[model samples]
Target: MSMAQRERQQLVEAMTAAGPEAPTLCGAWTVRDLAAHLVVRERRPDASPGIMLKPFAGYLDGVQTKTARKPFPELLEEVRTGPPWWSPLRPVDAIVNLTEMFVHHEDIRRGTPGWEPRELPAADENALWSFARRMGRRAYRRSPVTVVLATPDGKRAVVHSKPSGEVILTGKPSELLLHAFGRDEVRLETTGDPESVRAVLSLDRSV
Candidate 1:
């Protein structure tokens, strides 16, 4: 299966194993709340603008809250079955949902005790790296100094370039993606001038 499909299936399975009440790393969201978010994001496009636009957030929250009130089984079924036939996301699932699924899967997996990082296939790591590179600027846009993404083996990309200085964040592709997405559970090394590193670290990189 494609990485996106694999991750989506795995996320559903993880959600099933964890049950509705399980906590996720997504702030105060429970597994049920995350499920409702996934459902509303794909199925309720009219409300999805709130995901990135603050003005629509209240409307989006209203829709998501209502969706969460559905029976947990039905909510999960929607997430497992994928988007509806007419939804635009159906045709671009891999391009769009890969990171969304992977990160949220980790959110659930790592939020619980006894979790460990998975050894992902090299191709999956490459995919995450590509996505991270593309997202570099937007992810680190608020940083006061230049931000650099580096893999353990030395692959590097500049996120926010500044003449002043840069902070290098080193980790595996998956870990870098996690950190870029504002997840604190990832294992990564931040290096650079101490002052610049602190500035980068203090910046919120969440979507």
Candidate 2:
């Protein structure tokens, strides 16, 4: 199966094991809420715009609240089966969801105590690195200092640029992906001026 598909399935499995009330890295969202958000994003495209658009947020929340009331098993089933064939998301599932699923999967795992980063295949790491590079700037745009993301093998991308100071973040591509997406608890090394490092690290609030 494709990496994105595999990640989705793994997330479903994790959610199933964690049950509905488990806490997630997504603010106050429980596992059920997260599942509802995932399903509504793909299944209810009419409501998806509200996810990132402030004006439509209440509508999106209403849909999510309704979806979250469904039997947890049904929510898991919908997530595992994915969006309908006619859904717009189906055509670009991998491109859009590779990072989304991976990040949310980690959200559930990391939210639980005693969790560790799972080793991913090289192909998956490469895909994540590419995605991070593509999305890094927008993800890190609010930072006060410039942000540079680097992989262990030396590949690097300038996520944000500023005049005063810069911070270099180094780790495996997957870990770097997690860091870029605001999972600051991931194991990573930082370098650059002490002030810059502090500024970058302090900007851990997720986008």
Candidate 3:
């Protein structure tokens, strides 16, 4: 299997083992919801399953098969087959799909005990951070926050406004990433009126 495929397998295994009560990064979803989310791909020929999944269409225009009693191997096979039957989605459609698959998989693992997915290469982690950062541009402008990250691990992330200087925010990259992604700690971490950090978070935390 390719590295991506291997990673995909790990993702499936993690979700399957997650059972019902496991916590996912998406506070709204349980591990089971995440498994279901992973299994059901979309039928968008133009867009990949990740794109469809990202908007959380899984709950919106979603369908669940009566596979409750089915073996996990069978359930995973259904996901492997792709979902022209459910909706239109392109497989490996874009970076968004890969990133979603990567991040949410981590969410599932983060929620569960003894289910840690691989630590992810620093390069890979940085890449995802970079992607999110790039996508974060326009949204950050509207908010009044600037964020900078400093870490004991020597990893840092700096997100700030360019001209307006409304909000200034910074912290560890991972912390910043987590905060950007709807972490409760982030909300409690409001530093100043430059609530723009939270504003940026509110706007872009969807993924």
Estimate candidate 3's RMSD in Å.
Answer: 5.7
Residue 51 Cα positional deviation in candidate 2, in Å, after optimal superposition: 0.5
Local distance difference test, each candidate: 0.91, 0.88, 0.51
Question: In angstroms, how far off is 202's CA in candidate 1?
Answer: 1.2
- Give TM-scores for every candidate, taking all chains together and pairing residue i with residue i: 0.96, 0.95, 0.59
Over 1-207, each residue of candidate 2 has an lDDT whose tens digit, in order, gives 788899999999999999999999888999999999999999998889998899999999999999999999999999999989999889888778888899999999999889888988888888888877766787778878888999888898998898878888898888888877778668899999888788777775466
List the candidate 1 regions with Cα displacement exceeding 4 Å.
none
Candidate 3's clash total is: 18
Residues 1-207, candidate 1: write the lDDT tens digits. 778989999999999999999999999999999999999999999998999999999999999999999999999899988889999999999889999999999999999878889999888998899988877778899888888899977799988888888789999999988888888888888888888887887787878
Measured with C-alpha atoms, the lDDT of residue 186 in candidate 1 is: 83
The TM-score of predicted model 3 comes to 0.59
Ranking by TM-score: 1, 2, 3
Clashes of each: 0, 0, 18
Compute the lDDT for candidate 1: 0.91
TM-score leader: 1
* Candidate 3 C-alpha lDDT tens digits along 73-151: 6666655554444453345434435555555656766665454335556755565566545544533444545544434
- What is the TM-score (0 to 1) of candidate 2? 0.95
